[model samples]
Target chain A: MKPFPAVLKEKKRYVIFEIISEKRVKEDAVKKAFFREIKSFIGINGMADAAPTVVYFDEKSKKGVLKVDNRALKQVEQALSLIREISFNKCFVHIIKTTGTVKKAKELVKRGD
Target chain B: MKAFIDFVASEDCVSFGKKLGFSRLLFNELSRDKISKTKINIISPKSPEESKRQLRNKMIDIILDPFDKRGLFIDSAFLNIAKQKQISIGISFSKFLRADENSRIRLLHNMRRLTALVSKLKGDLVLMSLAAEIYEMRSPEQLILFGEMLGLSRAQATWCITESPKGIIRRKSL
Candidate 1:
């Protein structure tokens, strides 16, 4: 038999998760939890997509930058300020950004945190 | 054996030093007196694994109060150790560890960069030591976790000594 070539395989992926945040992200602990989970996936060299995603603040089409940080616990403070009320009449909106594998996107969507 | 002294005692790190027979110097005295910030330094560990472990343990404390009314609490003992060791002080000092959003934002940004660095390392953990001369400060907990999230083990673990000049050290050390 001719030389057998061994091919190694690893599942690498990039996924962007956008959430209409069922509730305005005003809880620091909740946001911290969200990012903390993200942290686990961030540095995996293989079988993972480690890239920084841009957080876009969208209201009335006015956009600014939001940093995803463990310190952004004040998101609750800010969310509390902006949330006049939350009711179950409308759909939560989110746009998954340009990225990688479908499996990654599914993983992000499955994250209830 | 010679002993090291810390003038700032933002936390029990000084007491820990005392237990070790390194003279307990409260950092508050130096910071309160408006002492020179440049007096101390540290020699850090070459292993990233150690720094990461310290960062993980201390970060639990830092994130406890990332932004609070009391602001960050810092101890000079960590700084003095860095100085005594003659090590290069790397990242993890807040230029202004304060409650203000502007300062906190910068601190958060730097913290992100640090965590990113930690994520990249090949070591089991990355370690770091910080030195702050102490001024009006911010949440010490945030400072601790920010380092922790980035893989700093213990801010003082790497160094063997911290130097505090006599008379300036602190009465609390007594």
Candidate 2:
């Protein structure tokens, strides 16, 4: 078996988003809430296909970066939007930008902040 | 670029929405008297007949929550009228925000049905936050994603938030 080349690999997208709430949130909690909502809304098969991951998160500023298959971008965004509460604090997730590479997404996050 | 607008219930929402990057603000109520202070006015019709009449009035920018009342608020007949008159229909995500478990299911069902109708008829569908406070408002990207979950395509959902309102403003200027 041979590994797929970089160009032949599945396309991925990085989403830069911010959490606005009365209190700050933790990275672990965000991951938990995001997956829970995604599972509930799109079911198990969709969740598996989504393959979402949290690449960057700043607890102090409440900003983070998420990675997922390009095809599941909408599902990931919807899951993030459905997250009303994180660890008992009411909150809202605002997606800032999406890019094909994490470098661009991180740059956008820095510029946004 | 895209202009984001939210139909809010109070004055505080104006500043809140502005902070969140909304360019225009709409005041939503059941009153016929226009709010001179605000640029955009959204009327929440009390009845299906009222909804139809509002949709035809060029002065009134949008008909909010046509499905809020009992029975079919936006039937095929009303949609035809709306499309011809170039009036936009608005749906508030705030309802889904506060709905209970039982009511949430019902709300989803109604919203899915509404989105389907709008898509089929090729009618103007506007997405509004209707946020009373700051936290209730969602970003433009989130709204588009929410629209997709309800059955609209990515491009269609984006149009609901951007072009639909722009068209309303363009019509007002004309």
Candidate 3:
């Protein structure tokens, strides 16, 4: 099958963020919490439109990257802010920055450390 | 750059607020004497009746979250009085952030109603973290995003964090 043209593909934004909590959280928990919160706020169809996926997460640093559809960037941000708890622990997911490229998002996460 | 201020529940979150890029944080604590030491005087009235009474006082810099209680806490008439008195209505983000799924829906409904009323009346409004702990504190942009979700325009949301709070500080001469 021929690959879709670049212009026809959905543009993505990489969000760089870190979890501020008392203890380190497992990557799986973070992923679960994010999906649940986003789905709850934007609903299942909106989640499909946003297409959020956990791209990277460092347990030690608690920094990570999320790739999402560009149009739903603000919706993703609202979802991130609404996330009050993860794995029964009170926490906040602080966004560092959002960029068009995953490489830039990773660089920001490193620089934020 | 715009300067932002947050009305918090304790002194401990001040450092965290600073880290989150807030220029200043005013404490809205249980002990009035503790917060009296500061130049800015803010009042978090318990009931809608108290909010009306406190709005008449020139000594009060802000009225924090009268909508937290269950009832018709604010209306066009209340906003008219607030506007005439140059008092700003404080909307705490944590109240919405911390509510359970059932109550969150109700809270959001009430908040959207308040926002619409404020816009219609052209009343002064401010948004704050009012975080009890560090974890509850959110960045200025996040809070503004919340304001937008509650039916404020982007500019109005920005003003809620910036100019509206600044107006309160300026009125108090702080």
Note the DockQ of each predicted structure: 0.02, 0.59, 0.82
Q: Is candidate 1 or candidate 2 better by TM-score?
A: 2
Best by TM-score: 3
Off by over 4 Å in 1: A1-113, B1-86, B90-96, B114-144, B150-174
lDDT of 1 by residue, A38-86 (tens): 4432324311233223343333222212233323322321221111112
Better of 2 and 3 by TM-score: 3
TM-score (C-alpha) between model 3 and the true structure: 0.91
The superposed Cα distance between candidate 1 and the true structure at residue A52, in angstroms, equals 28
The runs of at least 3 residues in candidate 3 whose Cα sits more than 4 Å from the true structure, single-residue gaps closed, are A111-113, B30-39, B68-71
TM-score of each: 0.23, 0.80, 0.91
Predicted complex 3: CAPRI docking category: high
Show model 2 residue runs off by greater than 4 Å. A6-8, A103-113, B30-61, B68-71, B83-87, B100-102, B167-174
Model 2 per-residue lDDT tens digits across residues A22-107: 99799999988877777776678987888888898889888889999988888778767767788999888888888889988888
Candidates by TM-score, descending order: 3, 2, 1
lDDT of candidate 3 over A37-104, digit per residue (tens): 99989999999999999998989899999999999999899989999889999899998888899888
Candidate 1 residue lDDT tens string, B1-174: 434433333554444334323443443322213323333322122244443333333111111112222322222343343234322223433222322434554555544443343234311111212223222121232233334443444343222123212322221133
